[model samples]
Target: MSNSSIYTIQPIEFRLDLKDPFLFTAHHIDHFPAGNTQLGPTVPSTPEKPYQMYYGDVVPGFPEHPHTGFETITLVESGFVDHFDSLGNSGRYAQGDVQWLSTGNGVEHCEMFPLVHQDKENPFELFQIWFNSSPEEKKQDADYKMMWREQIPHVLQTDSNGHQADIRVVSGSFLNTDALSRPPHSWAAAKENRVNIYMIRLEPHAELTIPATTATSTRFAYFYNGPLLYIDGQEIPFKHLVELKPDTEIHLKNSDQVASIMWLEGEPIGAPVAMRGPFVLNSTEELNVAFARYRQTHFGPWPWPTPAPVFPREQERFASYQKGVDVEYPERM
Candidate 1:
């Protein structure tokens, strides 16, 4: 068998449609002139703001939308996300906080980037990963939870050379560290499934080994930042997605000053997936039903006062669910 564990390393293509209102800005300090302008006419474009804005006449981010049949794990690396849903769920959280939304049956939601830093430029970055569920779990009720920054397990591993790697265990187990917790209906809930989500940052010239999966599973490593890195002696380019083989440890070496990567691994569901805008199901018939129900209900009406909502600048990280569940976290670091 080949010694290489990587299956594929594909670069993500994000061509910004200027009018789309979504901007992908990373690596640079975005400075906005002090004013009331939501988005300046001559805003500098980075990899982050590819689309510029999406229905963000007031703020920048996705507007009201609907989803079903899947879950969204939004890990915020920098900046805060204001969330509202048809089920009366709402939250305002920032850095290192995670929003795990299980939109099992159906739910309407809105994710807007409220400009909390109006006095200066509003800079932010995050990742929203979608996890599929079994056919039986698709018909369950909708729910969500927030993983606060302090609750997430952060471990630092140092090599013999004194270089260190900061590892954030978002889900699953790594080394001796475990994640905060996952939703009951999540695919990562079962230990036998061997699902893992980790964010690793390597100091220059650092070397680290990512543990292997127990059974046959799929693992994806997203090289989002840092200089070129060597994985098992193979060079990994920037902004690439590397798919690795199951049951093999990943030896990574940072060739340059510093590097960071996001790792996602789990057992493949091995089931058919029919996906449409904001929906995923097993068949076209189910997709059609989701659309029909969304049209009929409008997701129980938008409860928030505005399509793009923002909390007061002094507000802390918090989550409030439909069934009177509420959670508030300390200020984000």
Candidate 2:
């Protein structure tokens, strides 16, 4: 019998992999000379800090930029990301937090990595995925949201041998757990789309089977860091990408080390794509129109104090919307 699941498998190469400033403290003179001040990529760790700056200059982030006709989902694995938008929304979110922005029609935004720690290094790691929007939704107003770490659902499971797995549901439903609410215009918010975004961590030697959901939806797993993972008797090394068929379950076996993987599944919009710089649209005409409009208006003018504006240094994790709605996340233990 032919199995109806598990399709193309590939490896993922990050467009930008950054590990901030490498340390050379007095305690470890052997690793660096007395006055070594150069900065570059460092060893990767679970709690990555002071991530090397992949791009940008003094501020170490993407300063004011324009985006239209698409949405960006930024998952913060470590460190903090400050967001400022033309709509006057601003916030600073850190570890385990997520920022979802809908740049419908047009908008200008900035993502700056602010080193909040004084006595220690400020490490940062994150994934920014862009999702295409439907043509109608692309004309809607922009939406800015912060998915606080505490609000996102974490699903945990253990086997008979005590091996465990934890799945962080960033979007879509996982087992009995539903992802925190998404913006209204998001394609992931529609039930028919079957979009699933999850961060899965498996303990060493653990085994977990992810049940199949929608048969026609697209699904892919990005194994960013791990020793080894076995699927269908195939050995998947670290930094590999595995694509699975949506009709059947996925059996995962972690080798000797902890595994960190990202799961992204969604139905293809199947529309013509015309993308240029920060905008994604249906056709060349639409793309040109988006550019002309932004040039004419500057996306309604950035009202924030700075291009890479951040909240007060003492402020907690919170989002201040343009319409006067403010939501704050309480301090976590």
Candidate 3:
């Protein structure tokens, strides 16, 4: 309840305020109705429900968009995401899967959330994090990788009281578990960067101790879902972000209800950052050049039929890579 491990605590809105090496994080939790003929929400979003259709008229998702100078790590917690990109790659990934897209140089992609189930409610939840790239790496070739749910490591930690904490390692290492390899040009690809993204779910009344990370790394824990959490004996309310001293060990205790937290840690890139819409660059001049180039090239042109494309209802989880062989997962249990 009393410790110097916590630097600050703030409420989280639509996006979590992050530090260097991390540009932005958007948390989407939409309660969509049954699918229409087009597989979109049957009813329009209202002020009360506020089910955002974000650039998608027929679906609740983002249409084809361009990005540069950064990488997008999309973690799907529930529901599914249909992905289409200008590189002639497409995929339909579902719960627990992670998609890492490096828009180096430039790339265009669309992420559509389809209401596949017509008989029941389609509750969608995901976190899309923008990881910043260094100036030199920004000019590298674009790359993409998919870490399926089965490929990702899930570490279970049991406290002395027998309570457990389930941790999903998306990037970087935790305890003895190392995450899958990231893109070659990604800032996280360098071992010295110390970038780590972990999704932790604590059972009711669970207590877990997080070991100290590198002294130079910037770390924060976003408590997105839960009733109550205690950090170092300090009570932390739900939907709050806590900045932690990376060099100090941190203790977490959850209340009676299940609690979930997203922990992000990375060494700062220590570069001038200039962002405009989806483009991120080192300076305003570079940002302008990026826009001009996009207008000229349109990021290799949209290859998909529609800006927001969705797969057939019966199509299972799969990924069609541009330069690699296609992959298909086993049918959902």
Candidate 4:
């Protein structure tokens, strides 16, 4: 591994509004490109829109669009993603259900709120992670996979200090409920694979420190529930995702209140990135190809065998939002 330049949790300045009206009328303050304007236009683009665990919607039919070259893992923590695809698989992927869709070789999928959830009011939470696959893996298959909370290993552990965490293995080890400090003990192998993830709960004004390691890997953390901080000498503003350099230990404390954090870190996938409306690729040319394919015809050798229900409201709302909207693409790549 190579040493990475140090970085700080530049405060999350960008807020996006949900353009798709049929979807939840919400704002993703961190990275959603269309997060509400009320949060303002200053939301800077960092590593990108991180994985957001969205709950049930005020409406349905979100982010109504197509995708490919990525696998969206929607693990339903509470409600469901009543989804449909060009493959003709249409049904509700409900609470405790996990929806893993590989948009390889191109595929168009839509997520709509279930009729059952309409006004019924259900709490739904899901982690939508954008996992990158090698170009070869991207063309291997287009498919949908689902698993229940029971099927996946959900492990729990508590320390004598009254700190407990529930672990869910999602790609990487997913641990939640409590944050762990520098291990009293250490290991070589575990440290080598250092891409560990955790959801930590912090007590008011509680402080902790993350020790530096030898391997030149970067560490990123997101504070969601509280104003927990990855300190910067002075009180630097906090963000959902904070990036740090290797050998850079972190000092953290609740911002005078209880806090929660989602911490993720891994070696960077140093690839040229190109992204446009649900598609992320290495180059704009690839994106253009994807857009051409998406516009001409739904991607994949097989399109939906039958007609999927049209979310008219979602369509109209997305259209309206698309109007007077300028997608700010990354300038560097």
Instruction: Note the Cα lDDT for every prediction shown.
Output: 0.74, 0.72, 0.89, 0.46
lDDT of 4 by residue, 1-333 (tens): 122333544444332111100011111322223322221112333464432323323333452357876556564544445566665544455544555666776876666543332223233344554544445545555666554444555445454455443444433344232222211111101334454444455665656555564354546555555554535443434444555554666666556666655555544444565657677667888888878978787664333332334332222111111112322111211
Best by lDDT: 3
Candidate 2 — which pairs collide? 6-245, 19-51, 19-52, 20-50, 20-51, 20-52, 49-123, 50-122, 50-123
lDDT of 3 by residue, 1-333 (tens): 246888899898879989888887999888888887788887776776657788888888899999999999999999989998888888999899999999999999999998899988788899999999999999998888888998899999999999999999899988999999998999998878889899999999999988888888899999988889999999999999998999988999999999999999999999999999999999999999999999999979787777888998777888888633655563542
Ranked candidates, highest TM-score first: 3, 1, 2, 4
Q: What is candidate 4's TM-score against the reference?
A: 0.58
Model 2, position 268: C-alpha lDDT score: 69
Better of 2 and 3 by lDDT: 3
lDDT by residue (tens digit), candidate 1, 110-152: 8876556656655567777777877877888887988888788
State the lDDT of candidate 2 residue by residue for 115-162, as single tens digits: 555545555677787777888879999998888888899999997789
- Which ranges of candidate 1 are over 4 A from the true structure? 1-3, 15-51, 323-325, 331-333
Report the lDDT of model 2 for residue 217. Answer: 70
Off-target runs (Cα >4 Å) in candidate 4 are: 1-6, 13-59, 75-77, 94-98, 115-120, 123-127, 154-160, 174-218, 227-239, 246-259, 300-333
Worst 10 residues of 4 by lDDT: 16-25
TM-score pick, better of 1 and 3: 3
Comparing 2 and 4 by lDDT, which wins? 2
Best by TM-score: 3
